[model samples]
Target: MQFDEVVYRIRIAAGGGLLKKKTKSEERVILKGISGMVLPGEMLAMLGPSGSGKTTLLTALGGRLGGHLAGSITYNGKPFSNAMKRNTGFVTQDDVLYPHLTVTETLVYTALLRLPRTLSKGEKAEHAEAVIAQLGLSRCRNSIIGGPFLRGVSGGERKRVSIGQEMLINPSLLFLDEPTSGLDSTTAQKIVSTLWELANGGRTVVMTIHQPSSRLFYMFHKVLLLSEGNPLYFGKGAAVLDYFSSVGFAPSVAMNPADFLLDLANGVATAESNEDQAAIKQSLVNAYKTQLSAAVKSELDVDSSLHTPTNDRKLKRWSNTWLDQFSVLFRRGIKERKHESFSTIKIVQVLVVAILTGLLWWQSPVDHLQDQVGLFFFYSGFWGFYPLFQAIFTFPQERMMLSKERASGMYRLSSYFMALTLGDLPMELVLPTVFYAITYWMAGLKHTAGAFFSGLFVLLYSVLCSQGLGLAIGAAVMDQKSATTLGSVIMLTFLLASGYYVQHVPAFIAWIKYISISQYTFKLLLSSQYESDQIYRCGTNQTCFVRDFPSIKTVGIGGRGSIVAVLAMAVMLVLYRLIAYVALMRVGVTRN
Candidate 1:
């Protein structure tokens, strides 16, 4: 694999928070005309200080860069294509595996979603088992891959699982970002050794590593040292020390060569002032150009004629059919969400809120019109806020996972999205049902079964609509905190215009009442409760309930409006999901 003159830049957001403007965005260069190459049967380790363009270059080469990039990347002397991308795998620094899945299950799902359609279920299982053995994860194959709250796999084991996930596709070229960043020295060396073994099997592996142990450093076939987006050194790892020593920047003692290289790249011992550091860095660059460029060029200039085609077939960009993608994703989604959605704590929280609400408005009747209206308002508000906050976390929590899978060309955005939305529907419906069931009879709003079920249907629809709105917010913002803040603002605005709080909205903004889901819900509840036109003794004389409250009629309150509310919510649900799909496609891949 080879990349030449790669350039990447991003426009940073101008101001802080959600209220900021984008008018004054600034451009920050990530990669500046960087170029490099790696051959089969070799492992290249890229070394750089923080923000030295190492990961940026890796992202560009892996076709995952989410900024303005200009470069020519080629594999097998041809321009990089979708087929090449499918043949490449990239492992991010953070392992984004599902906590609920066991080691074997995770790899199995990855194989199902990524392996070719020609392979049968048995074939996929066989492949997954093979990978588990190859990665030395057979010992933990049945152990659950855990997160901060769930303890299961060790960190080194988890990292290996992440690599194994990519290996299931049998990729020819692999890229990793700081695979050993937080591991112990022994574990880090072991990981590199494993990578070295993989590379020895004729797979090209390129990775960005920080301050590696000397033993780990020698395992790499090539070393590309970068500083401030410039190549300070690029040559054989074993010869790096000799090359640097020849340039009069030799280590003072028998220290780890990786540490010495980092000191020079980070300017730790190179100079006492900024200008002096710049001079030292420049001198190193000049030395590399004069002394080492030829040897590097000769090594990288692999003869195209020498390359031989093997029996291994190239893989397609996506392995699963569209329907198959959705099915696999839906199954995975259901498995991952069952615990969160049906957790004892969440169920208990919903029940407590429902029972407390029911007790507050127990046995309410028509004469107590104020309390009935308040109850309806409370019901609408709770469902609105509950589903919105719950769905707000859906995208942010999965951002890294989605990014990794999407970059790997695993599945379509629409397929993953439809599966997620469909997978959550059962829970979304069931939770609201529990809330409605506990409160419906105790509150005594209506006795007729038709009205009760209709109200429940409308309530469920409203909650889903709210969930859709939350999903759109989460996907568009890409930050949980910002999504939450924005969702709160939106929920509050809807409540204020709900016709319960502001009974008489200003004429200039009267349109808000028409759009506020809460208003529609309140109208539907009122219509259901007063469908019989029952008489109430509010002032010692009988008076019709609808007559006392004429605003319900003007606001289009009835069974017809209830039907309209459900339909409106359905449309909003689809609309919001469509927006979310578009947002997901751009979340980590779009330039700001």
Candidate 2:
């Protein structure tokens, strides 16, 4: 693999976040004229501090970086093509695994999604088992990859699990971003040893490492040291000390070579002030460009004998068909979400709310028309906010994992989306059904089977709309706190316009009632229970007009005149999801 003349930059706003003026974005250079190569069966380690361009260079080599990047990267004699993509794997610094899934389960699902279609499901499972043994992870195969709140695998084991995921496809070329970060020295050594072994197996491996120990540092066949986006040294790991020694910057005392090199890259021990430090840095950079540039440049220079790079390599087909993708994703979604959606705290919250509402409105007579309308309106408001808040975090929580998988071409975005919207039917409906069962009979609004089922259907329909709206908002914002605040505002507006709060309103805002879902649901629930000509006894007289009721008039319901309301909500049900799909296209499931 080789990358030549790699350059990258970005444009950032000069003004503050809250500034109102249209400030011009300032251009900032990130990686500056980076160029290097690693042959097959060689393990290359990139050494740098926090702000250096190690990751940017790695991403560019992987064909995953975008944003004013100018470079030519090729594997063998071929350019970055579909065939190269299929044969390459990238492991990010953060572990994006589901905390609830066991290590065995994690790899098996990955294999099922990524392995060639020629393999059967049983074959995929066997492949996962082989990877477990190969990575020395068999002892912890059944352990859950835990998170901040859950404990299952150790830090080193978690990192291995991430590597195993990429290994499941047997990729020939691999790029890893700081895989040994945050691990103890012992664990870090073991992790690097694993990479060394993999490279020795006739595969090319490139990784960015931070602060490796002496033992870990020697495991790399080659090393590239970077500082402030500039290359300082690129050569054999064993010869770096000698090269710096010849240039009058070698370590003054015995020290880990990695530590000594880092000190040199940062202009350490050679400066007395910040200006001196900058002068020292400039001297080393000048030395490398003059002494080392020719050799590396010739290695990367064009050769007419090499095959011309092209993207014409036929891409491999996905492992599963579209239908099969949906089936597998749907099952996996259920397993991953069951514990979160059906936690004891959430179950108790719904049950307690239902019991309280039911007991408050227990067995009222038919003459109590106003109280009955209030009860239905309460139901509308509760379900509107309940389902909306529950769904507002689904996409945001999975944003990282979704991006990683999509970039890897694991599954079709449409298939994963269908699994998301359809697979939640059973889980999302469980508590609502329970809430209805507990509250419907306890409150004496309707007793007949026809009235009962119709009201249930309307509530479920409303729930779907509310949940779709949540999904749209979540995808659009992609921030938990911001989405939550927006959800609260939207649900509040719908509640205020539900017709039970105010009968008469100004002409301009009166149109809010037409768009409010709560108004329609409240009106439908009223029409299902009471007829237009129904009479009641009020104020010592046995004659009261139901049509003249203020709440009923605002919702505009009279004698089955709510067909438009039902249709509007149906449109909203599909419309919100379409909006969500478009927003997610912009946010969640993107590939570059």
Name the top lDDT candidate.
Answer: 2
Candidate 1, 326-395: lDDT as tens digits: 9999999999899899999999999999999999999988777778778877888999999999999999
- Give Cα distance to truth, residue 448, candidate 2, Å: 1.4
lDDT of 2 by residue, 375-396 (tens): 8888899999999998999899
Best by TM-score: 2
Q: Name the 10 consecutive residues with the lowest summed lDDT in model 1.
A: 308-317
> Which ranges in model 2 have alpha carbons more than 4 Å from their true place?
17-23, 270-275, 301-313, 558-560
Report every candidate's CA lDDT.
0.83, 0.85
- Root-mean-square deviation of every model: 3.2, 2.2
